[model samples]
Target: PLAEKHGVTIETSGDVAVSVGSHALLLQMTMNLVHNAIVHNLPERGAVWVTTGVRSRVVVLAVENTGQKLPPQMAATLVEPFQRGTGRTHTDQAGVGLGLAIVKSIAEAHDGTLTLTPRDGGGLRVAVQLPAAPPDTGR
Candidate 1:
């Protein structure tokens, strides 16, 4: 998998029940996060962790990776279109830098939120929280 190519370990845990959202948009959001986690990671000791679960009334999905420390301010701007982070500007793997931007946009359309935070030691963690769907009451 992509994790192997980057010498990163993939850890996944937890389970999230189905929620309401556009399948295509959710898949796109997930792909972007996973791709970024692999493409932008520490040359050594790279690791990616994926998790999903229900918290309170929300469905949560998180993608985290071992990477170089990202400037907090720059991390905030990463969700904006065409904005690239440090060292990303010169990479052939770099796209137009709209990955996170699109993820954030799609998240909002589904009544969800996207957050980016720098992890202790090193690396970044992104969490997407979406409102859980109401239980169906068959008539």
Candidate 2:
């Protein structure tokens, strides 16, 4: 829905291995990041890229979009609950800023870590890293 709203096409690649917990949480996290990218980006056609891969012992997932640059302070506080950026002018988007916070919590609960980096082309890339599932040993 958000991708269509901003005329932003989404491209996804790679795979993930989950040992436990509902896949819904991961889907929600991806949805939140994509929605934020669509809502915060400059109102021009853009693209959102979602990629997943295995990095050493961790599974890495990244969502990146094109948009206006974010202030360092605002970017730092993006994962905080109810935190909003100073440049935010959109009022129609219903968000209390708790989406990232929820994502963070869910990641932590799964023994994973979340990171956000400002992309070079005036956008943001959010990543979630989770430990790979342990090898099964027949008991």
Candidate 3:
């Protein structure tokens, strides 16, 4: 949906089990991240990928996208309130620049952590790590 509108491709994979405090909040977090990714992309032919998994009793979700190279300094402040990244100009009602900030708050509320890393080449990688829920075991 958004991928097509943004002229980008979206790829998702991995585990579907998430044990957040509220599913609705989780959905909001996902929406914000995906929206931010699509709206802030390279404007054409960009790619966004999301992955979910469990590691060391922690559930991990990562959203990465190709975009303008972000400076390390700028990236560190991306989670601050109203702090927009460079080249964030987009006509699609980009947002009030609170996506990462909201994501950080959501992760913290779940006793989790959010990390923003500038990708090696260009783009950014955002990771959310929270406590994992044990296997269902068909109970």
Candidate 4:
């Protein structure tokens, strides 16, 4: 919804089947990630790409978006508190800047890891990797 309003499109793909200690917390973390993508995207022709997969026994949820180029140093700070990038300032929605920080905390609490990287062309890629749930033995 917000993507459409911002003239940005969203594309989702891949296997998202994964387990987490808390579904509610995972949802919250996902929301923040998605929100950051949309709110920081270009004015138009912008896109948010979300993909999930299992790699090396870890479940990966990655969210990427089209935006400005961020320096490696600046990009590293995005997960810190109150570290909002030079995101789309003209947009109607602005955040209090705790988005990525909260995400980092949630990922760590689940024994997972969060990674933020600057895309080669432009934009940012955010990934959360969590341990896959153990197979249910019905014990």
Best by lDDT: 4
Candidate 4: stretches off by over 4 Å: 87-93
Q: Give per-candidate clash totals.
A: 0, 0, 0, 0
lDDT of 2 by residue, 60-87 (tens): 8788888778766677888888775533
Q: By lDDT, highest first, what's the ranking?
A: 4, 3, 1, 2
Give the runs in model 2 whose Cα sits over 4 Å from its true position. 16-19, 86-90, 136-139
Against the reference, the lDDT scores of all candidates come to 0.85, 0.77, 0.85, 0.88
- Model 1 CA deviation exceeding 4 Å by range: 136-139
TM-score of each: 0.90, 0.84, 0.90, 0.92
- Give residue 48's lDDT in candidate 4 (0 to 100): 96
Instruction: List where candidate 3 sits over 4 angstroms from the true fold.
Output: 87-93, 135-139
Spell out the clash pairs found in candidate 4.
none
- Model 3, 1-139: lDDT tens digits are 7789889999999987567487888888888888888887787899999999988789898999999898888889999987788634343465877888999999899899999999987889998898987777997
Report how far residue 36 has shifted in candidate 1, in Å: 0.7
TM-score of 3: 0.90
Greater-TM-score candidate between 1 and 4: 4
